[model samples]
Target: MTIEITGSAQWEAWQAKVLPPVERVADGLWSIPVPIPDNPLRYVLVYALECREGLVLVDAGWDDDVSWQALTDGIRTIGAHITDVRAVLVTHHHPDHLGLAGRVREASGAWVALHTLDAAVARPGLSPEERSEDIRSHLELHGIPGDEARRTVDLLDVGRALQSPAPDVLLEDGEEIRLPGLELKTIWTPGHSPGHSCFYQPDRRLLFSGDHVLPRITPQIAVYSQTAGDPLADFLRSLERLETFEVDEVLPAHEYRFGRLDRRLADMTRHHIERLAELRAAARETPGRTAWELSARLAWSRPWESFDATSRRFAMAETIAHLVLLENRGELRRGADRPVRWYPAATI
Candidate 1:
C-alpha cells in the first residue's frame, strides 16, 4: 500500500520502499519493527535493552498478535524473555506505543514509566465530568465542529480500551534511568505532544527519537488539547534542540534507522519553513481566507491519498495550526469568528 502525505512526496516514497527489519546492533539494544497494515507509512520501532537488573523495553508494540509475536520472538533471539522485562519505558502516550504496556507488564512484572504531561491522557480511570470536560475543552480549543467532535470523542474508545493503565512513574528531562547495566537518559522533546520525551544513549550515540524526529517525514505537532497556543513554535524549538545532539543513529518510532542527522534536521527545518511560506503565499493570494479554504487551495496532486473525513479534518487543522503560529509570530494575521476563521499574511 502507498501512503500519501500532502506536502511530502519523497518521504512517502522512502516509506513505500523500506521493509521493517529487526536487527540486534548492540549487546543490549535490539530494534524490532511493527508494520502498520492500514497505512504503509506507519511503522513503529520498539527497542529492547538488556540490563544487569533485567530486560528493559522501550515503547511497547501494537495491540495485535503479529506485533506482539514479533516482539516476543525478537526477545527470545536475544536470550531475553518477556517475563524478564523488569520495566517498560514508554516514549509518549500514543496508542501504538502505549497500547501493550499492561500486557507486557503482566507478562514480565515490569513497572511502566511515562512523562507527566502524557500520564494524564494515559491514565485509565476518569469521572464522567472529567471525561466530558476533557472532550468539550479539547474540541473547542481546536475549533473542531460540534458534530465531528462528538464523533471523534466517541471513537476514542480504542485508546481507552487498549491502552495500559496509568504510568506508575514519571520521566523527567536529564533524568537517567538505569536498567541493570544499560543506562538511558531522558531528553524532553515536546511539540509532537505536550510530554514527548526521547531517550538518548550517549555512549552508543543512539537516540530513540519517538515521534519528535522521524527519518523521512516531519511529525504532526499541533494544538489538540484544551491548552491553546503556538505549538508549531514549540516544535521548531524542539527541532533546534535535537540538532545539537551527536546522533550517529536515530531509532525513530516510525521508519528505518539511518545516519545524516544534521542533514535530516536541516531538511525537516527547511520543510517547515517552506510550508509556512506556502501558507503565506496562499494567504497573500486571497486575504482573510478560511483555513479550510486554504487547505483546499494547497497543492495536492496525489489521487490515491486517503480522502476520508477524518483525514480531511486532520489536514485542515494542521494547516490552521501553522497559520495560527505564523499569525502569532507576526508573519500572518487572522480574522476569527469562533470555528469559522480567516487568516491573512502579515505586512512585512
Candidate 2:
C-alpha cells in the first residue's frame, strides 16, 4: 500500500513530522490525532466509536498535558467531550498507548480495558525495585557491558518512561468488547508486547491494528525480562493468524490507515524471514558472538552507532528475540557463557 490510500490529508503532514487534523473515518467512527511528545511516532490515532450511551475510544494517547489537551480537543472536534467517553480500549501496556487511560477513566468515569496479560504487567503491582531488577537482568542477560548496562538501566526508567496505569477491565484473547452498538472483538497478537491486541469489527470489516501492522514501519518485536523466550516465533504465528480476518480497511495506531491486509502480513513475515537468514549467516561466519555484538551488526533503520542508550537496549532485545527464534529453529545454538553467545547449530 502507498500514501495514496492513506484516506486523509495526512501524507504531507506525516512526512513533515506534524500532527494531522482529526477526521471522520466513517458515519459512526472518528479518528483523533493526539500528539506524542519527542517520539519519532509524532501521534497516535485514537479512534472514537459512536454508541447509544456515549462514545467508546479505541486507544488513549500519551499521558501528558499536551497529549491530553490534543486528545480532549480532538474529541471536541467530533462534537463530544472526554467526559462523554464510555470506555477506553487499550491495545497494549506501552506507556504511549496505555498512559492516558487512567486519566481518561478519571475524567470520564470510563472503564479502561486491556488484555489480561498486559494488564498484569501495566498494573501498579510491581515494586520499583522489582522493575529495576528486571531491567538489570534483561540487560545483563543480553551481554550489555558493566558501565553501559548500568547507564541503560538508569535510562530505562527516565528515557523509555514506563508509567502504564492499571486498567479497569481485563480481557482475554478472542473475547468480544462488551460495548453497546459496537461489535469489536479483541484479537490477541503478542510479540511487540506479551499481550498486544488488535480490535476487529466483523460487520464493518475493519481492523484496528494497534502496532500489530503498520503502513510503513514494522513494530519493534523486542524481548525483555517481562517478555522472555522466543518472541519472534510468537510474532510470526500471530501474523499468520491475522491473515484469516476478512479486512476491508486497516486503522493502525501510528502512521496512516490502509487496506490489503494479506499483502502487508506477507511482507512483514518476509522481512522477519530475511532477518533470521541474515542472523543465521552471521552466526555461521563469526562462530560465537554475544547478543550485543550480533545486535550492533544487524541492520536497523538507523546506524547502530547513532543509537542512544534506550535504543541500544531495545535493539539488543529484538536481536535476542531473533537469536532465540533461530535457536528454537535449530539454526543456531547458544553457548553457555557468562553473557551467552550464539554459534551455528550444525557447528555446535
Query: Candidate 2, which segments miss by more than 4 Å at Cα?
Result: 1-4, 158-163
Q: Pairs clashing in candidate 1?
A: 52-180, 52-181, 53-180
Runs off by more than 4 Å, candidate 1: 1-19, 124-164, 225-227, 300-306, 345-348
Q: Candidate 1 residues 1-348, lDDT tens each?
A: 122222133234355776445677677778766655456565577888888777888899667777678778878877778898889889888777887787898887899999988886565476555675576555644455677666766655443543456788898888898765788899888777778899999898988888888866688766544435677887788889988888777777876666667777778878889888888888888775666567776754343144555565567667867887887877777654555455554443
Q: Candidate 2: which pairs clash?
A: none
- Give the best candidate by lDDT: 2
Give per-residue lDDT, candidate 1, residue 274. Answer: 84
* Candidate 2 TM-score, true structure as reference: 0.95
Clashes of 2: 0
Q: lDDT tens string, model 2, 1-348?
A: 332255556656787777888999898899898898888898998999999889999999888999999999999998999999999999988888988988999999999999988877675456677778777876887689878888887765533344577778888899987667777899999888878999999998999999989888789997777775677888899999998899999999988888888888888998999998888888888988899999888888889999998889888888888888988888889887777888988876
